[model samples]
Target chain A: MGRYFFHTRDGHREIDEVGLDLPDDRTAGLEAVRYGGSLLADDPHILRHDQGLRVECVDDAGKLLYTLLVTSVDAKENLATFATEKD
Target chain B: MFDRDMAPPGMAIFLAKLLSHSLLSTEDQAAIAALPHQTRRLEPNDYILREGDRSDICPVLRSGFAYRQKITEGGGREIVSIKIPGDPLDFQSMYLRTVDHNLQALTAVELTVIMISDFERLVQARPAIARAVMVDILIEASIGREWLLNNGRRNALARLAHLFCELHYRLLDTGSGGLDIHKMPLTQEQLADVLGLTPVHVNRTLKALERTGAIARDGRGIRIADLQSLIGTAEFSDLYLHRDQP
Candidate 1:
């Protein structure tokens, strides 16, 4: 069991001080994307790339796990960018 | 209709802007300026108009934020739209008897209300004003269609960014605070209701956007960090807003 904290931001700020237990960091990344999807689902209308939103995941030991970003440069593209220190 | 003194103070402040933008004549403006309206202040979270409440008055948001929302069948509240300064909250009530959504003050608000009967009476008398009002209504309809496009197609990041872009552009008339900052009174939970995202999800999206240097917020205000890139992500186009009407 691993503990992970996911900090979220839309057009504003929200910090996640409490961490949650997940199977692994991969699962954490997936969870964060799902979290983003839920946000997209809730608002009737939404975002832009510069105002685009994202998630940050950290381990219980305060180690940075990974950063997840959803970006779209063209109208036809929606890409997810994930940055992490380790495999 | 009201004379200058009889009109709600809130409505009076926005009259010139509305007249100039709608392209109505001075006499037409006089007609609206004469309305026997009422003004009131609401504490935050107070319900201004709820679903099923049929009111004959159309409210003008003089200051602060108001929200439009509907309740889902599953007993969840979904925010439909946010109203800022100079908006006519529940303008549709002129024709419809039952309100489709609830209007609430998201912050302490000053609302000036004009009775639909008086407004309609003026419209009946002045063909030009009526035409101008119709144009305004059409513009609002177009904005709604754009929102439909936002919800049905855009991804999460684009969805939030698009909203910021729209606000930045709209608030320009309100004397935008140094080109990028504006009052953002809605909490993440309220924003979540409007965005259809949970509070937790909104938190993550915000954190991600902050990390990417897209936006920043302090207290009840938000600033656009990167305009062009944010616009690119949302595929935002101001054409639908019709900000410039010849």
Candidate 2:
């Protein structure tokens, strides 16, 4: 199982419970969209009215991989505690 | 061409010269000179670029101030940096092929837009200009880092003073500091947004600075009573802005 950390508008997370990070090329492709777009430094397509970044993690190369999109980055501390308690 | 009334003539000419020396290659300038285009004038509230819109044009400020800022996830707005005349607006996205931030005019301004394709064509034809544009972007990133320092570490008063001193020197570089009172188009509310502070805090700080003889405020402008003293109070050094080099 591949491991990966995907950063979204909300926060970062580990994917697949496998702890194996994805390839750089794969990561960079995701990063290109997250950090604005491929051509622009910040995504101009993200309007001012849009909410903050909501990120999710993908575990594999499947068309619809098992991914979890976190809701709010402000809740990172709470999420960390929850993850720890679950573990 | 933008409306000429949008910017001071001297400031416009100065900006063009500075950009010509800094961001533009000789060939790029020649290409720009050869282009037959009209200039558009932008008022204080006009946006040069929005945060998430795709536009095929980027403007070079002939005069006045512009800044990049964003509303954070926490409902916070962080002003990334203050732009002076001659600064290349959105040059980063022009090359990196993406738009990262929103740029808005801080005063009535003039802009000369070069179509993105034409600009890229110029870059492809003149690879050296590409390198220069890259260097300019790196400088902007460095500036962004410094602003992080300012916001995270410095208090309200220090941040305000630092901004004034920084602008004073930057405008001086482009020969715009000769005016007795500089046009500081940003309202205290806007300044608070940029400095990551409340409007009340910004107002109190400005008043305190005025009372302490650090800065003199006259309507929309401010005059530094004592440059060295103001710098001391602000704990500011020009080293970070990197204006000394070309």
Candidate 3:
């Protein structure tokens, strides 16, 4: 098992000082996804502000392992523009 | 013939805990103090007992912290209870065949292990001691019910606040140097498991709590800045702890 840090950015950077021990990069990637999901669930407003949520998983030796990102787009605005162009 | 003054470090704490729960006679206290026991030290994450394990021994937390947890098949873990210094680790083993949950060290801990046969014999011989043990077990069950409500109903902020309040009161009851909130043992991940929240949510809720001036962060340690504010936030009630009993 190796130690993995899950640093997050959602309009602000939060560095994880105490990393979790996991088996490999694959597991770390899964953990990052779970962490990002939790962040999004806690506050979905960040996506509404056009700011993407990101979780960066790094190894103990300062190596970047994986990154999980979540973002949203205003599809309704795009649909409205498409309707106007068709007319 | 056991002398209270000559009792070992852990034995005194154990006796004090029982005495707080029930009115044990002098002979009963002496019997407990004289019980044959061994002291063991364990590091964090060490398993004291696992589900389905049958043991003839009972452990008492001499110092530091321990917790009981249940794990799901999907690798999810939920910490059901936190044990503090002087808390008996396995009273259930005396009557039950096997453990139902995992007991693990939450921090570096010292345990006083006694044979279940010996404990059972002493309880049978001393009605007061048996009553004390029963009260202790019932109190634990009461706390468990409150935890159910805390996890199932309370919001994230109230959930975390309620936990802090409970821990503070429990430590105070232990008479084990009270709680130094700055030196709180559980990590954020552990806290998440205890409160039924994720680490990200724990972090965010902590910041929200800090903004209320209920807690202050100094590097890795957190201190209780305004306990009244915290109590208000949690809507805490200590009736479940049963500190007033006996």
Candidate 4:
């Protein structure tokens, strides 16, 4: 098991500098994608850059974990995008 | 310490190096590293991959430093970020069809080439390792955000200070130097590209930082004469970095 940190923002104030002890980031990432899935339930494009949604995950030692980022609606890399496309 | 090679093979060594930045289990890391990989050494400014190249394998920096920069249509180069020892310079190319930026060696570099298919399989098999890589990518993304803030909001002097502070922590992560002094291998032009300033502006910024008693220039290195003062000048906080490991 490993500890993970969360940093989320939506064109406003950000949350960071704190970590939660978890099994790992992949587990945490699944939850993030799931949440993004829920947040973007209607449109698979809510997390798009035009929508200005970003979710970042990092490790305790200041190393980047990976991010759920969206540049456009068609971007298939975001958590919400993954969720919408999930089987 | 222990006899390096006598302990294990290439994968084991590679896994040990990754431990500094990841929390993957020995078995998982070893299993992934055991896959096919090619190791090579590169000189400074050597191109690991150029913009618009169609490459499949990813370059994992095993030693030294690297930088990712993009050349504009007008032939101006902009340094995006500096890669530490454990940084996978182009891991994203695993999915993206073509390269968008140029990745090059900033020092005598050591890179390990890992096939994308093999890595994907390894991650699919080892969920734990997958988590670690995700965490690493997230961390890099966060750094990008912080850099954006520096460029958009901070002045030239503060931008330079912030970059120096960020480099200090990154170098410390790589065990490159002591608590205060770091061996800065970057030249003025390279630094300017990262900061979106001219070389002359970078020089002036450095001198300004020195005047504030925040840093002392030591040849190609820098000594943080006053850590708190430097952080204050840069409005720098380690918060965005999310560092907790020693």
Candidate 5:
């Protein structure tokens, strides 16, 4: 079974997963790659999806710093999560 | 000359030393031990290395904090990882191609220099240590992937929780022990730098966490009032942290 989860730092949350025979394509995983550069960037911003699963980077005063797009996979590595920048 | 008191406090440094002895073996460790002591002090915000620099040595951090950041072509900076006291910086660069990022100090830091020539020669002389070093690099890559997941999919709140949990486990792995409270040295800005959030948002999220009793905040530190609950809140899993099994 493949399960993935994502949410923000406060209280909001979202999760999804698929086991064998579950239909999915590289599209979702590829979407995860979009944020790669932004995650690597040093500013703060928030990145989320229609599902409400989100990732944001902020400072001490609650100001936005940078942003990232997070994704997960259950490949041979067991569980893999990737963080990317939102820019 | 390197001062004995300067090494950072963590498993990363010990792991390096372990590799030095276990991987380098008795004769090689003796050789390295015999070499003249060399050390360097970094001022706050100093760059120990930059992208495109030759990776001639893999430094074992003895004291202070540093982080890994990459500058994009458009002048954007992305912070990938932080180095605590025991961590070794640039091991990946040394073993691989040209450095693709910068290693910069978060505070005035000290580094115990391990010359690449000596290290490589030692590795050649001792395959076990080389293997250990290789394992460490792979572990780093896995951590990178997890950070990516934290940034890509997890919401701001979950991301923060996950980061805290991750740090707690890492610190504990290094023999760092305390109660639920954690003495975090990172400012919100620094947190945002790593988590890819804004200071304002970071503050708001922290406030929410505090209000809910998942965490407590003071000036520069934090109190993890509920560790298990916090982990559950973050939906964190420790499989990727690479701690040695008991």
Candidate 6:
């Protein structure tokens, strides 16, 4: 098993000093995605204005393994343009 | 007659836990000490009891920590309760036919395993011990109810703070008189499972608690920096623990 750190950013950067032990990089990638989902679930307002949340997974040697990003797009302007095109 | 000095290792702590909840007479204590039992040790992640397993022995945790958890169909685990040293590992087996949840060691654990028949005989012969056992089970259920409220209603910060406060009080009640506020036993992943949150959220909440001066980081573990502040943050009450004897 290897130790992996998940550093996060959501308008603020929080460096993870204590890392989790997992079997491989694939598992670390899944963990990063889970972390990003949890962040968004806890506070969906971060995605209100197209702002994004990021989870960066790094190994014990400070090597990056995976990055999971969660964001949302405002589709109201796109819908208006589509309506004009239809007209 | 069983000599107190010759009692099995970890027996004193188990007796002390019962005595804390109910007054056990000298005879009752002696009967408990005289019960036939064997000591067994387990490493971390070792399963003491698995779901749906039938066993005739009830194990009392003599030292180290364990937890009860349930797994969902999707393979997600939810930890229901944390067991400390001196806690009875399987009181339900005395009356129930099958185990309901998985019990695993969170650290290197030592357990005093007693036959269910022997325990049942002792409980029938002694009324005070029976009362003590009942109180212990009731208190565990009460803690479960509080955990439900903690996970369903409280925020992450309050949930973490409340858990630490509960642990502090429980360790103090063990009567061991050696409560180490620094060496917390649960990992972030374990804490997340307990609180119904992810490890990332657990980490963030721990940092927030540190900022409030309720706890401080100590390497991989955390120290209870300010108990009063933590209690205030959790809005914790000891009524659920039922430490005071009636």
DockQ, per model, reads 0.22, 0.01, 0.26, 0.01, 0.03, 0.44
Which lDDT tens digits does candidate 5 get at residues A10-50?
12442111111112333223323333333324223323333
| lDDT tens digits by residue: candidate 1, B1-246 | 435445456766556336535766667767677678778899998999988897988888888888888887987897778777777786677778898888999999998888888888887899887776776677777877887888667766787788878877766654424226554566777767877665566665666666667787676566788888778877899988787863
Return the lDDT, model 2, position B21. 33
The digit string of per-residue lDDT tens for model 4 on A6-80 reads 555554434554345568778767645543443344234444445455666677776777777654444455777
User: Distance (Å) between predicted and true CA of B4, model 5?
Assistant: 13
Worst 10 residues of 3 chain A by lDDT: A41-50
Place model 3 in a CAPRI quality band.
acceptable
* Span of ten consecutive residues with least summed lDDT in model 4 chain B: B1-10
Instruction: Pick out the ten consecutive residues of candidate 3 chain B with the lowest summed lDDT.
Output: B174-183
For residues B1-246, write the lDDT of model 6, one tens digit per residue: 545556556677788788778888777888888788899999999999999999899899998999999999998999999999899988888879999999999999999998999999999988888888899899999999999999988878899999998988898888543224536789888999999987777988899999999888766778788888999999999989987775
| RMSD to the hidden true structure, all candidates | 9.1, 16.8, 3.9, 20.1, 14.2, 4.3
Candidate 4 per-residue lDDT, tens place, B114-184, comes to 88888878878888777767766777899999989887778777788888789788766645563375556
The TM-score ranking, best first, is: 6, 3, 1, 4, 5, 2
Worst lDDT window (10 residues) for model 2 chain A?
A10-19
Model 6, residue B65: distance off in Å is 0.8
Name the best candidate (by DockQ).
6
**CAPRI accuracy category, model 2:** incorrect
lDDT, residue B9, candidate 6? 63
Docking class of 6: acceptable
Chain A TM-score from candidate 6: 0.81
lDDT of 2 by residue, B53-139 (tens): 776775777777888888778866777778887676866666555567778888888777666776677677776667657666777
Error of 4 at B192 (Å): 0.6
- Candidate number of the best TM-score: 6
Q: Could you tell which candidate, 3 or 5, scores higher by TM-score? A: 3
Per-residue lDDT of candidate 5, residues B1-246 (tens digit): 433234333223545434422344445444445443357898878999888888788787777778888877885567899776666687776567788788899878888777777677766767666776677677778889999999888877888888888877765654444326546656676787788774445665677677778788666668788888889879999888766531
